[model samples]
Target: MQERIPRRTLLAGLGAGLVLPAAARAGDLAAAGWASARGGEGGRTLRVTTLAPDGPGSFRAAVEAAGPRKVVFDVVGVIDLGRKSIRIREPFLTVAGETAPSPGITFIRGGIQVESHDVVLRHLRVRAGRDGAPDRSGWEVDGITCWKAHDVIVDHCSIAWATDENLSASGPRFDGGDTVEAWRQGTSRRITFSNNIVSEGLSHASHVKGEHSKGTLIHDNATEVLIVGNLYAHNLERNQLFKGAVHAVSVNNLVYDPGTRAMHYALNAPEWEGRAWQVGQLALVGNVIKGGASTRPDLPFLIVEGQGDLDLYARDNRAAYADGRPMPELRVLPTTPLPKVRRLARPPLWPKGLKALPASAVEASVLATAGARPWDRDAIDLRVLRQVKDGTGRVIDDEKEVGGYPK
Candidate 1:
């Protein structure tokens, strides 16, 4: 946390999130960090599953074959697990779903769990069937859960119908009677949640939370998360939840058909009571949110209710209601004047990279390119994808969209 400065000091450029060398960064630092996510490059490629027991055979077998070394495995067929899930424990692993034989790996039941560092998941589709309790207990399933994990990227996949959350990156809890130290949960750091379709989740579409044991939530411990260029749809609440984060960036994303709330940014000092992230260096720019037809009927565009102080900044984010009318600026309570941009992704994810397209363009691209490949856009109703044009005068459609594995 940065030390507080008097209003006069801020006028002289001495505020917490305001004092920065103007020439330190060039162009969009958030976009560069997001583009530099390369998973399992040093590992050997092992082809697995799809009917005929080919090269490395089953997904589990190939991962075990890699042993402790970083391995890149191409899932070449459909894996129909009845009520099970696969957890990748090895660090530096990549699961390329584009290599799958047909529509990519479709989990009629199971899901993928990356509990390791330097991991990447792309070009896959996970469908958690209805009545989402695999254990026959209360619904608490996630399409992908990165617990106590770091240096990961989840991209170009379509995940749907999770009872709890579709995607989540949370630290494990530190046991201490009832209440536990949030910072002491785990050393989970340097993760990117981007370029994927996380929709139809019963709870939060995505959860970027830390370990909250008792009633008191601690977000001062979660750090270095980059969320970019993805489509969030049909979630019960929090299409994108920024409960607590030390240094987080959300850019060029679209939220369609929101259920409860669209997004939240709560940054205060010390402890942010109920959320799970610490607000260190925050950058929230170029986000598009909409629902209904000319009205955003979910909750609010974003909720800024916490008071724990940290470097906070938000800009270029627009929202529309269900009636398709433009919504007003966000309401940030105990409002601190909008801060300036600062680069926190040092040695960025992509030192020489690019950002996702603009939200107007991203909405069409996400819907067109999301889901498995070989999908007939002519078959599905175009209205389902939120095909709306923006001020840029570009028709939102499947013209330059990109996702999934190329045939």
Candidate 2:
């Protein structure tokens, strides 16, 4: 006689523990942009019927023409561009390109700039294509940039290969000097950065540069950011730079093969500059950093190269070392403290619907969904898919290769 084991128990033991939390369902995910942007939900629909970069019925024209209307301009085909950047100065708008006929708009020499509040940009692909001139040319610029805008959301978009940063949120500021009541500058607020692929930036992956700088846009006061569920890869450094900001929450992001630095939270204000050196706030939670065997030690799981006074709080961050083992701790791997550190006592504000998935789950979810894509687009070319986790290539837009949501 043999003892029979229960089928349910056996099946449970065999499971690989791969599950998407019910709280993070697709319906909830779709509404995140609207919620974050204070109802930037793009009330009306303005279908873009062509691939023209910036003329009649084009993306730029529709957005510029849309006055006093909370409209969504849905792009239906891949729109190519030359030297002119698509600039938007309106409020309460949505630009959707998830259903483009081709891989979406490929920016050979231009990018986009949003300068208003309550805006949503979804499932669009803006890549500074590889070609003639050097990357130093200012014309080969950022994918999407915002200045002093608030309650904005960027989701499921793939932006890459920019001479500057792939994405930036900045505004203007004055260098506060010897005492006449120091005042704040044009600072952006309540901005959500999530569910996207930002990579191959020549200088930085994402630049949140604010304060007294030469940058066209500099937002120094009251900049609060919600950054989560994104994929950062193949960028040289500055995965996310907090040059001048007060609050930012970084969670559940997958950083695959970052170069010199994972993040730079600094007060770039020079010694002769303003009192802005004493401003910063950041929190790192549940982020997974997967580095190759060749990654340098200085660029560890995370690094701090800013003024020691920068307020930083880190927890539950995991890293895969060069030898392919989980890093035991998330301590600064340096031999000496760059400067006497300043750890924050208060934690960052967690958004309403953010769920903390495991490091593995987060990586998988980002890999499957981040970029000019849904969770179901992955029929990639061998040249691209081979380096999807590390190097840069033609990111395939085939939703068929992707599996179910967070499977």
What is the C-alpha local distance difference test score of candidate 2?
A: 0.54
User: Which portions of model 1 miss their true places by more than 4 Å?
Assistant: 1-38, 50-56, 64-77, 131-136, 173-185, 203-220, 267-280, 293-298, 332-356, 371-407
TM-score of 1: 0.67
Q: What is the Cα root-mean-square deviation between model 1 and the actual structure?
A: 12.9
Q: Score each candidate by Cα lDDT.
A: 0.50, 0.54
| Predicted candidate 2 versus true structure: per-residue lDDT over 1-407, tens digit per residue | 00122334323322321123332213135325213564335255566666687667677776776543333334443456775778778877776554454434444456778788777777676665323443233344667777666677777677765655677776554434333123233546677777777765544212233110111122344355767777776555566666554567777887766655665554444531645354466777788876653245545565545443456777778887545766543333332324344566656455565566655466555654455544323332111223544433321111122221111
TM-scores of all candidate predictions against the true structure: 0.67, 0.75
Winning candidate number (lDDT): 2
lDDT of 1 by residue, 165-199 (tens): 56776664332233324453464556676556665
Q: List the residue pairs that clash in candidate 2.
A: 171-217, 171-218, 171-219, 172-218, 376-399, 377-398, 377-399, 378-402
Off by over 4 Å in 2: 1-43, 68-75, 99-107, 175-185, 203-222, 325-340, 344-346, 375-407
List all candidate RMSDs to the true structure: 12.9, 8.8
